[model samples]
Each structure stands twice: as structure tokens, then as C-alpha cells.
Target: MLALERVSKTYPNGVEALARFSAAIKQGEIVAIIGGSGCGKSTLLRAIAGLDRASSGTVTLDDEAISSPHAKIGIIFQEPRLLPWLSVADNIGFGLADLPAAERRGKVARALERVGLADKADAWPRELSGGQAQRVAIARALVPQPEVLLLDEPFSALDAFTRRDLQDHLLDLWADTRPTLILVTHDVDEAVVLADRVLVMRPRPGRLFDQIEINLARPRDRNSPLFDSFKRNVLTSLDRSLDRNVPDRDATQGPGQAMWW
Candidate 1:
């Protein structure tokens, strides 16, 4: 189990990015954290990955405090961050240097196959399309077969069709081998479709505002009324949280400027 107890983060500039946030995630469960810009989603993900330290409270996985980077935890960022000179297979095996050459090759091969990129194993990063590059990134992250995976808007940059394809791929991988995954995304529909639970956060001292459990079955149909209902609930919760965070509309909005969501 992964647990965050009263966790908070404050920068040296006195900006409190995260408040007393707390949540318990089950083993192998997928959780999505969503909020507006500057809601500390990045900070929270980094802290959980032990890339950043929480100013207060504690984050633990299986009862062990996460004070530094853990080998069992893997993070996927917004960009592919692949080395331009490396082949797809080599990039996926970058972290496996400690293993024997044969073992590393085996792991990389399996990961490439998992991401449907076995044919592109020898291809350079520049040779792949946007979606293919992201697949390589996913393969690199999954090569370790992390028990806990943290994704920070990994597919936000892709086109709608590519994004949907990657989402389907993610679900397939999860079904094959469930891992405790946390996906931080701003897209409400993405969260509803992908997460076992949705955490709606409030900004300006980022904190959890609501928790929505997804009771729907796998291979979720976005066209289904049940999916629409869940999406509506998430939107309503986000709007309510915005209502609390955003001040009077007239004062916040620029003169003669309007915004619609």
C-alpha cells in the first residue's frame, strides 16, 4: 500500500505548493490526481517519487518512508526525454546496467514487445513519430517493471487519436500486470476513463477536495451513460473547488475578456 499522511510542500520562496494532503492508495490500483495549473500535482508526484522532499508529513510505500529515489518506483514525465544517439532498445535498458548484458537484453526486448515497438528496437529516437516516441518512453519506464509507476501528463502532447490509442495500450498493460499507478492529468475525461479513483484537488495551497471512486468495469465505454455520469461528477467537483479557489469573476477577469470552460 502507498500512503501519504498530512503531506505538505513549501518552497524557499515561501510558496506553499501542497497543503496537508493525505491519501491511501491500494496496491496495484490506478489513481488519478487532477486540478488546475499550479495545483502541486507535479510537486506531489515528485515527492512521492522521492525526487523532492516534503516539508512536513510523510509518504510511505509498504510502510517504508520514501526519503530517496526507490528502485521499485518509476516515473514517466511529460516529455520522452530519450537520448538522441541511443536506439529504442538501448534507451529502455539504460537503467539496467547493473544486470548482465544477456539479462538486460532480455528485459529490453520484452519491454519493446510490450509497447508494440519490437520492430523499432534498433531505430533512433528521431526516426519515431510522436506516439512512437512516447511508446518508447513508456517502455523505458516499464522495463524495470516498477511496482509503483508515476505518470505526469505523459500523453498530454499527443493528438486525440494517438492519445486514445496510448490510453488503450495503458489499460491493456495494466490488465496484464497491475501496478500501483498514479497519473497526474488535467483532463477530467482521461481521469474518469483511466483511474480506479479520482482525486479532485483545490489550488492555492493545493489540497485534496474530493475523492471519486470509479465503480465501472474495465474497457470502459466513453459513450456510455455511466461514463458520462462519472465525468459530470468530476467536472462538478472541479467547478465547486474552483468556486472556492477563484475569487469574484468580475475582479479576476480582465476587462472585456471572458472565459468559458
Candidate 2:
């Protein structure tokens, strides 16, 4: 499991980005974090990725503490961030240098086939389209088969068609390994389409405000009534998190029920 215990972060300039936020995610679960601007969405993701340490509390995968970047954790940002000089195949195998050359080649070949980029194996980053580059990025992250993958608005920049295509493609890849996926996104539809649960956050020293369980099944139809209902719940919770005056819709189960702190 991936767990965050009383995680808090304060910048060197005396600004607090997160405050005692906590949650425990089981293996193979897909969780989406949504919030208003300045709500520390990226801040929290960085803490979990070990790119930034929390001022207090702890982040752990299974039983191991994470204070620095770990091999078991992989991160994908909004941009592909591929090496310009490297071919698509080389970029995907960049982390497999420790493996023998033949083994590395085999892994890279499989990744290329999985991402549907086998034909572009020798293509440079500049030669590929936006969606293709992002596919390469996803393949690169999955090549190592990390225990957990952290994505920060990875598909926000792509067009609607491309975004949806990649979302489906991502799920296909995810089903093979069942790694824990923690995503930070602003798109409610995307969140509803991809996550098992949606975590809403409050701004100004961001902290957990609500957790809405998406009971819908996989291969969900975007236009289905059930899918829309879950999306509406997340949207309403987001509004309440941003503005306290917004009336709560579901009073039965209070906010932060799934949170540890």
C-alpha cells in the first residue's frame, strides 16, 4: 500500500502548501486528487513522489519510508520531457542501463510495441506529434514497472480526442501490471473516467476536504447516468471545498472519511 501520514509541507519562505493531509491507498487502486488553484495539488504529488520532502509526517510505499526518489516510484509531468538527442527506443530504455544490452533492447522493444510506437522506435522527440510524444513518455515511465506511478496533469495539454484516446490507452496498460496510480487533475470528467475515488482539497494550506467513492465499473460509458452522477458529486464537493457557503449535498458521509488524519 501507498500511505501518507499527517503529511505537511512548508516552503523555505514560510509559506505552508499542505497541512496534515493523510490517506492510505491500497495496491492497484486509481485515485484522483482535485482542488482549486493554490490548493497544493502538485505540492502533494511532489511529496508523494519524493521530489520534495514534507515538513512533517511521512510517505511510505508498502513498509518502506520515502524521503528521496525511489526506484519503485515513477512520475510523469504535463510535458513529455523526453531527451531530444535520444531516439524513442533509447528514451524508453534510459532507466534500464544496469541491465545487459540484449535485455535492455528486449524491454525497449516490448514497450514500443505496447505504446504502439514500434514504427517510431528510431524517431527523435522533435519528430513526433504531441500525443505520440506523450505516449512515449508514458511508455518510458512504465518501462521500469514501478510499484506506483504519479501523474500531474499529464494529458491536460492535449486535444480532446487525443486526451480521451490516451486515457483509454493508459487504462489498457494499467490493467497489465495493476500498479497504484495517483493522479492530480483539474478535469472532473477525466477524474470520473479514470479514478476509483475522487479526493477533493481545500485551498490556502491545502488539506483533504472530501472523498467521493466512484462506484462505477471499468470501461465506463462517459454518457451513462451513473458516470454523470459521480462526476456531479465530485464537482459539487469541489465547489464546497472552494467556497464554504456552498451547501453540502451528501450529509450522511462526512468529508475525509477515507483520510487517516
Candidate 3:
């Protein structure tokens, strides 16, 4: 399991981005973290990725402390951030340099086929489209088979159609390994479509406000009433997180409950 115990972060300039946030995520679960600006969504993700250390508390994967980047953790940013000089195949296999050449080549070849980029193996980053580049980025991150993966608004830069396409594609790839996924996203639809549970955070020294469990099954219907219901619950929670004055709908329903079901 991946666990965050009282994790907090305070910048050198005295800005407290996160405060005593804690959650225990099970293996192979997909969890989305959503919140308004300065809510520490990215900060929390970075802390988990070990890209940044928390001011207090701890992040551990399978009981191993993570104060720095660990082999078990992989992170993908909003941009592809691929090396311009490297080919698509090379970029995907970048992390497997320690492996023998034949092993590295075999893994990269399989990843290319998996991402449907086999024909673009020799293509440069500048030569690919926005969506294609992002696919390459996803392949690179997944190729390492990390125990946990952190995504920070990875598909935000693409068009709506492409974004949705990649979302489904990501789920397909995820099924292959079922790694623990921790995503930070602002899109409510994206959160509903991809996450098993949606974690809503409050801003200004960010902390968990509410968590809504999405009980819908795989290959979810975007137009289904249940999906919209979950979306509304998340939106309502987001509004309340930003401003506590927003009246709670169905006050009897507890946090993490799917009211429609």
C-alpha cells in the first residue's frame, strides 16, 4: 500500500502549501486529487513522487520511506518533456539504460506497440502531434513498471476529444499492470471518468475536505445519469471546499457516498 501520514509542506518563504494531509491508498487503485488554486494538489503529488520533501510527516510505499526519488515511483508532468534529440523509441527506453541493449530494445518495442506508436519509433518529439507526444510520455512513464505513478494534469494541454481519447487509452494501459495511480486534475469530468475515488482538497494551506467514491463500473458511460450524478457530487464538494457557505445538498448523505445509488 501507498501511505501518506500527516504530510505537510511549507515553502522557504513561509507559504504553507499543505498542512497535515493524510491518506492511505490501496495498491492498484486509481485516485484523483482535485481542488482550487493553491490547494496543494501538485504539492501533494510532488511530495508523493519524492520530487519534493514534505515539511513534516512521511510518504512510504510498501513501508519504505520516500524522502527522495525512488525506483518504485514515477511521475508525469503536464508536458511530455521528452528530449528533443531522442527518438520516440529512445525516449520510452530512457530509464532502462542499466538493462542490456537487447532487453532495452525489446521493452521499447513492446511499449511502442502498446501506445500505437510503432510506426513513429524513429520520429523526433518535434515531429509528433500534441496527443502523440503525450502518448510517448505515458509510455515512457509506464515502461518502468513503477509500483506507483503520479500524474499532474498530464492531458490538460490537449484538445477535448484528444483528452478523452487519452483518458480511455490510459485506463486500458493501466489494466495491464494495475499500478497505484495518484492523479491531480482540475477537470471534474476527467476525475469522474478515471478515478475510483475523488479526493477534494481545501486551499490556503491545503488539506482534505471530502472524498467521494465513484462506484460506477469499467467502460463507464459518459452520458449516463449515474456518471453525471457523481460529477455533480464532486462539483458540489469543490464549491463547498472553496467556500463553506455553499449549502450542502442532501445533508444526510455522508462523505464518500454515491447518493444516486
Candidate 4:
């Protein structure tokens, strides 16, 4: 389980990314964080990942304190961030630099097989399509058998068909590994379809405004009334949060630089 206690992030420039945010996530669960563009969902993920420091509060994985640096949290960012010069297999195995050659090969092969990319093991990043590259990213993150997987809009860039395919693949991967997942995405349907719980965050010094449990059975049908209600509820919560956060003048200022909650 993951526990976030009074977690907050305030930059020196006076921008408050998170303010007194707290939540608990259990093992074998998929949670989605949704919010306005600048609501600090990504910042919260970064803080938890130890990519950035929180000005206050504490984060712990199964009660172990997380300080300046975090360990065992695997992350997949918006981009693949793969090495241009390395083959897909090499990129997936990059984090396992200290492992023995044979062990690393086994791990890489298993990961590729999970992502359906074993055939592309030797292929370069340039040779893969958007969805393929994202799969490579997923494979790399999964190779280590992380206790938690943090994905920041991993499939947001792909076309609709590709996105749906990858989403299904992700669900399958999660079912197989059962790692606690925290996905930050702007897509309401994606959140409803994938997450066991969806957390809606308010902007500027973000705080949790809503905690929604997705009751629809999996594999969720996007067009089903149950799924639609869940999506509508999440979006409504997000809309209300944004309206309450943005000033009257700023409301006319166009979409805030917020990210998905």
C-alpha cells in the first residue's frame, strides 16, 4: 500500500503545486488522478517518484519513508524517452545494468513478450510506431517487476484505435502483474475504463475534490450507461472544481496550464 501524508509542493517562485494533499492506495489497484492542466497531478506523481521534492508532508510505500530519493517506483512518461541509439531490447533492459547478462536477457525477453514486442527486440526506436514505442516504454518499466507503476498519459499521443488497443494491453498487463498503478490522464473515459478509483483534483495548491469508485465491471464498455455515468460524474466533478478554483478574470484567460488530475 502507498500512503501520502499531508504531501505538499511549493516552489521558490511561489507557485504551489500541491497543498495538503493526502491519499492512500492499496496494492493490486489502479488509481487515476484527474484535474485541470496545472492542478499539479503530475507534480504529485513526480514527488512520489522522488523526481522532485515536496516542501512538506511525507510519502511512504508500505510504511517505508520516502525521502530525497525514491526506489522501486517505475515510471512511464508522456514520451517513450527511449535511447535513440539502442535497440528496443536494450532500452527495456537499460535499468537492469547491474544484473547478470543471462538474467537480464531473460527479464527483457519476458517483458517484451508481455508487451507483444518480442519480435521487435532488436528494432530501433525510430522503426517503431507511436503505439509500439509506448509498448517499449511499458516493457521497460515492467522488466524490473516494480511494486508500483506510475504512468503519465502514456497513451495520450496515439490515434483513437491505437489508444484503445494500448489501453486494453495495459489492462492485461495489470491483470498479470497486479502492481499498484497511478495513471495521470486527461481522458475521462480512459480513467473510467482503467482505474478502480478516480481522484478529481482542484487547481492551484491542488486538493482532492472527489474520490470516485468505478463500479462498472471489467472489461468496461465505453458506451454502456454505467460507464457513461461514471465518466459524467468525474467530468462534472472536474468542472465544478475548476470553476471554483479559477478566478472570474482568469476564467476568460482560456485553459489554465493545468494537467490531468
Model 2 misplaced stretches (Cα beyond 4 Å): 244-261
- Score residue 3 of candidate 4 by CA lDDT: 92
Q: Candidate 3: which stretches are off by over 4 Å?
A: 244-261
Candidate 4 structure lDDT = 0.86
| Candidate topping lDDT | 3
After superposition of all CA atoms, the RMSD between model 2 and the true structure is 4.9
Model 4, 138-213: lDDT tens digits are 9888888789999998888899789899999999998887999999998887898899999998887788888999
TM-score of each: 0.92, 0.93, 0.94, 0.91
Q: Whose TM-score is greatest here?
A: 3
Give each model's whole-structure lDDT: 0.87, 0.90, 0.91, 0.86
- Candidate 3 all-Cα RMSD: 4.4
All candidates: CA RMSD (Å): 4.4, 4.9, 4.4, 4.4
What digit string (tens of lDDT, one per residue) describes model 3 on residues 89-148? 999999999999999999999999999999999999999999999999999999999989
Which model, 1 or 4, shows the larger TM-score? 1
Candidate with the larger TM-score of 1 and 2? 2
- Give the TM-score ranking, best first: 3, 2, 1, 4
Error of 1 at 178 (Å): 0.7
